[model samples]
Structures are given as structure tokens and as C-alpha cells.
Target: MSVAGVGGFGLGRPRARRTAERASRKVARNVGVPLLSIVLLLAVWQGIVVFFHVAPYIAPRPRAAILAVTQNWSTLWPLVLGTIRETVYGFVIGAALGLSLGVIMAKVPVLQRLVYPVLVLSQAVPIIALAAPLVLILGFSVTPKVVIVAWIVFFPVTVNVLDGLSHVDQDLLNLARVYGAPRWRTFLQIEIPATATPLFSGLKIGATYAVTGAIIGELAASDGSSLALYQEHANSNLNTAAVYGTTMLMTAIGISWFLLVVGAEVYATPWQRRTVARRTWRRAGGESDG
Candidate 1:
């Protein structure tokens, strides 16, 4: 091969190696740091329990919490499944309604004027305060829990969607209008895509809140088989380890649900991801060249 070919091969190999190194570093940053932090946290927790001679009922050690989960897995698994179902149902119903309302309000000035204040006022009333009334009216059933979750999710989704819609570039919109693009066509093509990021931001926030809403709803109602119910039982019985384990499970569920939303967002907006990756690569390449 010519000297040019040899030089090209040398450069290509280095670039490939750099790319692999970057990818590995990214993975380590994402996964390794979190794992290390958790291990450190557990160590500190165990140390505190041992050093303080803390009673198990007041503050169970990390091992005790893990034991609680393992020992009660048969009972806990059903409760976890129940809570997951409630969270999904609530998130779907809430997201749909919020998106619809946000779109309608954004498109119609009259609707915005009439409805925005009501929406703001609705959020002013604490969801926990309404829990008892909802239980009384809807009874201690899944319906009430679903409604509570929907209520918690609706505000964030609506507000983010409205913010997204409002921020659409006026120049782009005017250009579309000047080009004789139909309002609906322009909105479908331009407005929706432009707003996708903010809308998903809202959805992610709602997803995080969904499980908490379900838990709160369950706690408000007396009879139910959910993590919240299990927690309440554990608290009453002074099974602190079980209470901690239930909490950990709920937190894991919430994180999983949030990540699912993020995955959906990434899938739905491939262009956005590509754009981000390009910018990141450019920045990295520029730094290296410098």
C-alpha cells in the first residue's frame, strides 16, 4: 500500500480506539458511579447501626431491610404488581386528558382565558386533602387511586405542554402561514414536533409522581393490597425493616417508570437524539483538536 493508505489506516485505528474509549467512559460514568455511591451509602448505614447500637425497630440496618424484602417476597410481589397496575392506568388517563386540554387551550384564546385560572386553582387544593373525600365518594377501590394519580399527574403535563405550545417560534409560524400552509397542517407538522421535548419533560415528571400518587391513594383508603398498604401494616406492627423495604421497592418502581418514559421520549424523537449526539461529538472533537 502507498504511504497515503498507511497514514489513513493509522488515523482510522486511533479514531476507532478513541471512540471505544469514550463509549466505555460514558458507560462507567452512568453505571459505575451510581453503584459505587449505593455501596458507600449501605456501608455508612450499616456502620451507623453498629456504632449507635440503634434498635432494629427504630432504624433497621441495610441487611435487615434486604432480609425483610427477601423474607416477605411472596406477600410483597403481589402488592408491587397491584401498585404498578394502578400507576400505569393513572399515568395513561392523566397524560391523555392533560395533553388534550393543553392542546385545546393553546389553540383557543377564549378557552385559555376561561380555563387557565380553573386549572391553576385546582392545583391549589392539596391532593392529600381531597383523598378522604374521594374515598368517601368513590369508595375504597382502584377507581379512587386511579383518580388520585391522574389528578397528581395532570397539572405538570398540562403546564409543560402549554409552555411548549406557547414557545413555538412565531417567525416559523408566520412563514408557514405565508406559504399558505393550512393551520392544521402546519400545527401537525411543525408545532407538534417542536413541542415534543417539553411535552416529554412533563410526561417524565408525571411518571415519577404517578407511583407516589398511587401510594397516597392507597394509604388514604383502608382496604387495599399495595405497597402503601403493606407499609401501613408494617408501621403499625413496628416492622421497621419491612417499612423500609416497601419504601425501597416503591422508589425502584418510580425510577423504572420514569426511565420508561425517558426511553419512549428518546424513541419518539430520534432526530433530537441525533442532534444532541452530533453536538456532543463536535464539542469533543473540537476539544481534542485544541
Candidate 2:
């Protein structure tokens, strides 16, 4: 028996164990780093409040804000859900309109010229001012909130889609044409795939905007909105804990939306991960060689 044959199974066992260990470490880092960052932030916040002897009305300690969230979970949970519903409504409508409009403009140059300026002009107006009028016209209901969110979402997505369409690999498309592929096939196979990355980039941008739009809409509505409570706590009751807690919740919503879009991108573009890994491996090997 050869020496290599004798130790093949032993070598395989160690290789499999090392692979498992690496995966476990990656999972731990993903979860642990975020937790560590949050702990450090809260510790710093608590320290600042203590060191300055900050008044409760001006700024409460981190513990106070956490207690506010826990104690008011029943009331706050429903409000959070409502906010999420408004966000979803806005995102869906905005994304649909953006994709449709992007395709139309790409196909028809005259319409693109006529419509592009209007879209640009619409974004110029202050969103806060725009929200009030929408509330006045649409009334203090979910309609105004949905409109606000949708309007904010539409512009970014359209721009990204347009940019992506412009950058499709023309040489590849010409090659497909030479091979007798139909225009529809080339578009579906080449154009859409080219645009997926930028489309998701737009979605991520819109995700953050959607959160802000919902909150802005809520302030205008004056109904069961979290920001309303924040204003009341700050201006009337001088309750810093409630104010800080509300801000934290709002931040969480925005982060959640961004992460949700990121997850979609990861799932939709698996090849992107492989491409990134390949580049990293090449760079590492070059450094080692140097």
C-alpha cells in the first residue's frame, strides 16, 4: 500500500472539519459584530448622561428608553405595524410605476424627453411642504401617506432603471442578433439581467426614503403615529425617554427596510457573490506572491 492511500481518509476528515469551523466563525461574526456595536453605543450613551448629570427631561439614560419600549409594547406594536403597512403600500406602487415608466422611456425617445423634465422638477419641491398639500387634498388618512411614500420612491427607481438600460452590453446584444435571436429574447436575457444590480440599488435607496415618507405622512395625519407621540413627549410632557425610544424605533424601521432589500439582492444575484469571492482570492494571492 502507498503512503498516500493509507492517509487519504484521515486527510479528508481534517479538511471537512476545517470547512465546518470556517462556516461557524462566519455565522458568529455576522451576529456578534452587530450586537457588540449596539452594546458599545448604549454604553457610551449611558456614560454621557451620567458624566454630564443630564436632566431627565433633556436626555434620559439608555435604561429609561429601553424601559419605555418594554412598558409600552402593547400600544407601540400596533403603531409599528401600521407604519409598516403604509411603507409597503408606497413601495409597491412606486416600484411598479418606475419600472413601467423606465421601459417606456427607453423604447420611445420623444416621450422620454417630454417626461424626464417633469420628474426632475417634481423632486425639486420640498417633501415636507409637498406632504402638507397632499394631506389637505387627500385628507388626514392613509391615502396621503401612501402617496407621499410612492412619490418619494418613484424618482430614484426610474433614474436607476434608465441608467441601467443605457449601459447594456451592446456588443453582446449584437452577437445575439448575429445568432438570429429575436429582439424580445435579447432584451429578456441580456438587458434585464444587466439592469438587476442597479434596480436593487435603487430599491435600497427607496427603502430608506419610504421610512422617512411614512413618518412625514404620520406627522401630517396627526393620527396614531409614533412621531406624534415623540412631538408630544418633547414639547408638552418633557418626557425624554419616550422621545428617545421613538427615535430608536424609527431608526430600526429604516434599517429593517434597507436590510430587506439587501437580502433580496443577495438572493436574486447569487453570481455577484461568486464574482466578489473570485476577486478577493486573486487579490490575496497577489499579496502573498509579492
Best by lDDT: 1
lDDT of 1: 0.88
Which portions of model 1 miss their true places by more than 4 Å?
1-18, 222-224, 275-290
The residue-by-residue lDDT of candidate 2 on 235-254, one tens digit each, is 57777798888888888888
Best by TM-score: 1
Our model 1 lands, by Cα RMSD against the true structure, at: 7.7
Model 1 lDDT at residue 250? 94
lDDT of 1 by residue, 176-262 (tens): 999999999999999988989989999999999999999989889748577887898899999999989888899889999998998
In model 2, pairs of residues that clash are: none
